[model samples]
Target chain A: MVSRRGFLQGGAIGVAGSAIGATSGSLVANALNNTAAETATAKRQLPFYGKHQMGIETPIQAVTNLVAFDLKPETDRSSMLRWMTLLTDDIARLSRGEPVLADPAPELAIGPAGFSAYVGLGKSMFIKLGMESDIPAGFIDLPAFKMDQLEEKFSGGDVVIHVAADDPIALSHATRSLVRDSIPFASVRWTQSGFAHTPGVVKSGVTHRNLMGQIDGTANPQLNSDDFASVVWMDQGPEWAVGGTQMVFRRIAMQLDTWDQLGTKSKEEVIGRKLASGAPLTGTLETDAPDFAARLPNGLSVIPDFAHIRRAAPEAFKERIFRRPFSYEAGISESGSVDVGLLWCSYQANIEEQFLPIQRRLEEFDLLNKWTVPVGSATFFIPKGPEPDSVIAQALFS
Target chain B: MKKIAVLLASVLLLAGCAPAGQVEISDAWVKSGEMSVEGGMTAVYGTITNNTDKEVTFVGGETAIAGLVEVHEMAMIDGEMKMQRIEGGLVIPAGESAVLEPGGNHLMLMQLTGDLMAGDMISVKFDFEGADSITLDSVMAKPAEGGDESYHETEMDMSN
Candidate 1:
């Protein structure tokens, strides 16, 4: 599978090379000159500008905040344009390791720290702004599943800003800066902060574990590959979404107490993957394809019928989603249970075709459901990235 | 069904520890289990410190809210998570504590008599192998906290 980190490494080099190439010669030779200037600074910086938004395919950061905002009752299209313009300026400065023009805490924004921000729109935003026609055909809210126990707190918002960085200080600063900038046009709807492995805890290229201790993101589409481009980036949506994707943010709460009852062997049977190595029951390595038909002496399937992978994996080749989930631990419930779970985030070219079919299968009868519950949910149409001198969502507003 | 039957019959004993004092519970509380149009389930969590020199086994528990108050565990199985009743008793070693927090090991309250709301206190009796059962009253409150249980709107000003 194409790893997100490897993809960003390649992106960083290309971006740095192009920055130098810009001053050299012909477009093709500037590309050559760009290669000559590969330096330490270039490797550390992720390109701020691209055809697609940066955060979607960027390597998972050490810390992140997924925040949504509801438009103020009197805010209109002009107010939205102003909000986007200011947000665009702030992002451009921060992505380049600088502070916003009028930043109150310039010190907090000193290091870019691999910062990237993705902005998206909700269905309500379209209706309120009288741009319902621009809402992409694939941008509808997720249909309710039988297993969903959604609460309104973590649910709806008109706009979402997914900000992340390798440093918690940088990520936190950016989150505040953006939200502060947004206050005039919108009210805070909800905000969820989460993390993965601290920068160096895991070996490079390894998948991160969820709160449940399962190695996740193993079956994701190869980042920056042709398959990923086709499966995640939009081509048939409104012009604004040409290189964008649909996003789903669901806050799933894990029932850790009940989950503790199972033995290691029983746990293995539930997920069809080994806890220690994250490999399939019929395979020894994490990357080996599962042998679904392999059975035991009693002729039972090696991976049970209701195993999560069996249901989550689709029979149709094109039905797939790029899951980029982050583990969240807000606090403790009144009962002293940990308020922990995955900020279940995913992106795909089309929600109706790529994501729903698989979720439907899991909802029907995945053994995993017994210990995990979906308490919050929302969907957004992430607009394509901004070009230099232009703002995010510019294509849609224009 | 087969798994439950096998687990129920399985009994475990802790080999070492102080043989006196028995098991004790602390910080015991409950979140009012919501029973909206969709059915709901609530849980009880606390610290069970084994005071005796010998290990004590948790066989099960009883409560009036549900027809059955079984001890259940939740963990990642086959890359997916699952919660199941302990067929064999959960063993607590002497001098050590078995902390029942949400998402780990706790009392699974099912078939509630009515919606468990905040300010409500319910009674439950815990059964142990080496000592007599102890009944305690637990208070129910909202899951997590803040206005109407919303995380973002209530916590916007809080630092990440």
Candidate 2:
């Protein structure tokens, strides 16, 4: 097997870094700014320094790249410390529209482009670093569901870096920069690219449409609200995970060619929502609560018993989770079918409590499962953001 | 990947024929490579060509592998995708072939009496709109092989 150290020792990092930077010239703003703006929607910068990571609760950007890395076999705690220190600085400098250490083509850094990077450690990292005790409760691998057709290439990793920006090129450049810097200690395992509606494409607060053309993410708790904090952040855990949350990422493959044959009425019955508007079967608006008790003129329930919304509905207030999903298209397959799917991501205080029950219900009997398959799945513990002088997860090393 | 390939193979079978001037059934095959741990659920694929000048409807069918065999269609409806029992029978237009394959239209064999292994033979029969009922014997074949294609092939090239 070719190790990451071997790949970097050949002295090709500079070439890779420069190529990434060279491709983003058109995406960066022509003029540069010296002062940073404070608004979340500001074009130039998103504050990287914070109590919690900026990427988690900050407004979702237009583009995202989720990349996973496996640590080299020789990597140790000391190597991890060095890696984190460099990564934290790189994140800070890039967020400020500055180049990372030894950036071959520094010009690309001039446009932060609303960039933000969130880092997390996968379960295997704890065992690899000999810090298994630090693995927080509810951080284990998710129990396999009935519909999972997980592919090895997309599943597990030792660490993950989620990079997002308003510009696709900017996102690509930053992701390349990070991978280049970690070349000696880690190797890329998988990378999933996705996009959302461009900023201002729709009303500011409207839920985004998934590839399936359904209004998704309609019930997420408002950012920075008390409910958000309660549902997403961990109040108590290992010292390093105090404010951190657990993230569940599942790559769900949607079979659109087969799905295209269904009628509008059948589709509505499956999702329990109106096609034109995302309203429940018995409601008039998108946010209207679905009345599972309501019936039709024929004396049958309006929403079918197997409708997706009914199966995924939480019984109590605390069962909710914060969902941020992105749609991805790989390419056309040999069979002339398009490979499209959702990068279904969720953040919650505890995976066992908030996410599993919902997934179990969907697995048991959701009508929507017929055309969708879960092909990739993983779980990670995302550490909270750091102060200006401190590095992320700095406490774990102690 | 093997499961996907087998499912694709089941979809690719296009041969089917029946005696006389009616529907020709050919290329009949069953897929059973990797049934889910839940087990018992498998699919069959074949092509039904209408030989008559008029359209023929496939009323229903029965199989020895399971107690109940249903003609089901899988499709995305209004942003939601589902597979439901075809309310009426499947219609094959005159002189056209109705191909039942994975990810589209196919046979759903439920409540199996035994696990279908390689080399097993499944017997099934279908009733058409105007012709005599026909029985088909499909041999269970090995699952199709899946090629090793890197999942990251479509991303921007990363090689230095």
Candidate 3:
């Protein structure tokens, strides 16, 4: 029988060998096992230090642990600084395949697997720290929506830590390390774990389908493009917040049982996209601009006015957001219904200018809203990436 | 000539030639504890690097919040895991590090003067043999897991 230790050692060797093979510009000629190639892809390491936080612009990983923390009553600015420093140290070490300080299970940290951690501060944090005046321009609490069934348990927090990795074990270890270091200054408000396709399971740049089986985020700006920078990174915020962005997080629960009852044609009309290709009703390609004014034989618009894509479309040049979302399944609900949904996360330079307008339009009238409910909502300001040896949001403390 | 060369080598070693550094600590933290009617206890964990040529021994430590401190290890006694105080100090080889971690070796603090709540920081001065005492500010934290019950039990197997 193959021992656990032997299997682990073999996996590690396979990963290293595959990495060397890939870098040598030669097709791996069946010499390395398939498990080794897949393992190497899963073990890709993302640099922790950069112009912006790693997870925001970096491609989404396979698994995510989104944890929110509410600061303790006794926590003050100085204590918060210490907490940030400790968390920052942990992130830097864990992202590079090293164990955090005093880690009880250092062995679990061996596989970084494209690990990245993004830190964000909620509006309540400013009030708690007595820095409300320094809150970035256009960063505010999201207005209550008409379709919201918001629960306090998953609604708000003083701080948010978003950690992701392609490997679940690596993600779990990193998440635990950060949460362990945080309890000293804060209490956990909520934790939501979500996931996507494994690293090598799908082609690299394809849009992911949500729980509803509809291709999501097809309208998102291309990564690293100038359009992405304008839509996702702030340039006119407070000096300390420059290069940072605003995030709107919502837990949108899907009513799939009822949604499945609708006819395919009706579903297509509701979303205004083809089920097979995600292309607009009036276009053959997913990237084609939808011809909103096209008419059919009955003199009705091909893309229905109440369609989700039509309603969510930007009316002006600046009304846009960069979406990076994940799918979540929490098993069955207490009522014996399947519990699954989308953890919708969007980044924008200015929430007021970009995100709110589209959301308001959707709230006013979107056919797809009948099958989706906003159950939890929160907003945060993700500060710029920290320099080497510095903690996240160090300028706030100064 | 041989005697003169030996004396020269001894002089060089005594004149700070042995790595030329002092002991340092990093990632130091203390587990949170409450002060009940009886008392309170916690443990400190971190990495201690000995940079000097001679081996350094961590004898004990002093903190304003704790009345007593000692080096401890978790060992199996009578087929059960038990906490025990190391009679001799924990030693670190020259230019090497000794990790004080949970479920392993650590520094125990007992008879706390007050509650060591989360978000609080306490100063600890570590006494060492063949080195100067180093003071560090350790944050009080409550880890999610990792043998936390042993620290709270307060029963030490001193039979050894």
Candidate 4:
């Protein structure tokens, strides 16, 4: 399949000077220069004003800064509205490559590079704002799981911002702009920066691999498909949250040292998929449906019962959640172990119905669990996108 | 001077047309004074578009939250970038814009009555040369990233 990113790249290369001598060294050099120029000058942008938030359904960017903020004691509904307005203006301007008002380094604001910012409200936000009754049903905080060793610093916040861009400079500027604007109303609780392969490095539409080397997000609902809309967008909720969804963000650390001890066969058995092609044990392609019932000559299932994929599979069609994950590396730990993990984010219309059941299964029994630890977890209710001339969650404020 | 002659000729030509239009300000915002104590300072920024056929001069402005206001500019003095008061005013050519931005020409508000928290709105009345005064509501906001350099280096003339 020609992925959207591939098509864009193809278009870009096609428009450049002709490659008359296709195999010539000079042609290759010229092509490389053109690609470099394209990466530098392409002002990619994602619209900030839309029916739903941009980052939710938008293709993943090269880098992300997931920041959570705790509201100050004095913050009230009125003050929250003001903060949202300020953030909205900042996001809108930064997404379009325009500097926010009083931007100190306006020059750094250039090149939006597909920049987008998503805002979500935690359970505490509604409580503190005296709007607990307005919290969308099924948007409660996740119950503690047996596999969790969640840290307080990374766990909870009143608000969270997911800022992403293809270019690190644009992402950094946008994140700083929003965080600085939030100073009066909130304080930074934690920040987790994650990255995927740089744009153009990976072929478009290829599923991203986690730090564990397993192809991730293989079973995700196709973007813009009806299945995705139903699974990821809220159609039944309070007026303020009709187009919003619930996000379950967990920082799962990988035990790469121990995982590396396993041979290819053991790793495949643990994940129920080929590490190289990401194909299920019973199939040849990543997109092929896993045949969980397929039996071996010894009468054992092709995909082991405790395999990660098997345990994570949805019991019912309604239980599926859309996953948009990124890998994070925080350098070596105190013990000299590599501190790397998956910043797993799953979006669903109802977290209770779609996400928890699958998570419960994984927590109970997944062979891959031995090599992964959940260290940080939080759930947030992302509100509907703002209308023109209004801030996000304007309905809730009203 | 040729510049003065052209200015006079344009004024005469505009006088023959319909009455001059109003000066408009947009994207108006003021820096939060939260970091500063009472009687401290902040700056206002926006684009002042002169829709009038004649040139418009922004002399100064006043806000209920500030004791004094002045037009200031960031200029390259010697080899260093320095902030100084614009002596006369900022001129916006007819149908052109004069941008009051950080690291550029701005309206400086000094002797703040109290801390201007983010999200607060202050009404500022702008005084113009040969035009009616315009009042606008500027939202208070913390400066965007990298916007603090000028504030740290500004050599304010407190006596003014």
Candidate with more favorable, higher TM-score: 2 or 3: 3
Reference-based TM-score, model 1: 0.63
Candidate 3 per-residue C-alpha lDDT over A166-233 given as tens digits, one digit per residue, 9 for 90 to 100: 88899999999899889878999999989888876766542677888887878889988999999999
Better of 1 and 4 by DockQ: 4
Give candidate 4 misplaced runs (Cα > 4 Å).
Answer: A1-42, A333-336, B1-26, B35-41, B49-54, B62-88, B93-97, B102-104, B109-115, B121-125, B130-140, B143-160
Candidate 2: stretches off by over 4 Å: A1-44, B1-160
Candidate 3: share of reference interface contacts reproduced: 0.23
lDDT measured at residue A104 in model 3 versus the true structure, 0 to 100? 76
User: B5-121, model 1: which lDDT tens digit per residue?
Assistant: 433322111111223576777545565423311134566766678898888888778877665566767655566445566667778998888977555777766656666543334
Q: Model 1, range A1-398, lDDT digits (tens) per residue?
A: 76899989989988989877875548767576556532222234577677898887766776789889999998887667667766776687678777554344768865777688989899999999999888887788898988889999899889999998877888888888788777767889999888877655675332688878788777888778888888889988677789899998889999988887899888888889998889998899888889898999999999999888898987898798888888899888788889889888889988888888898899998999999999999999888888764678876775
Q: Indicate the residue-level lDDT of B115 in model 2.
A: 70
Model 1 residue A312 CA deviation (Å) reads: 0.2
**Weakest lDDT window of 10 consecutive positions for candidate 1 chain A:** A36-45
* Residue range B1-160, candidate 4, lDDT tens digits: 9767545434332222323486777677887754444778888888877888888789998998888899988887677777788889988788998988777888988888887777666778889996677766444455443344657656444354
Native-to-model Cα distance after best TM-score fit, residue A203 in candidate 3, in Å? 2.0
What TM-score number comes out for model 2? 0.63
Top-DockQ structure, candidate number? 4
Q: TM-scores for all candidates?
A: 0.63, 0.63, 0.77, 0.83
lDDT of each: 0.75, 0.74, 0.82, 0.83
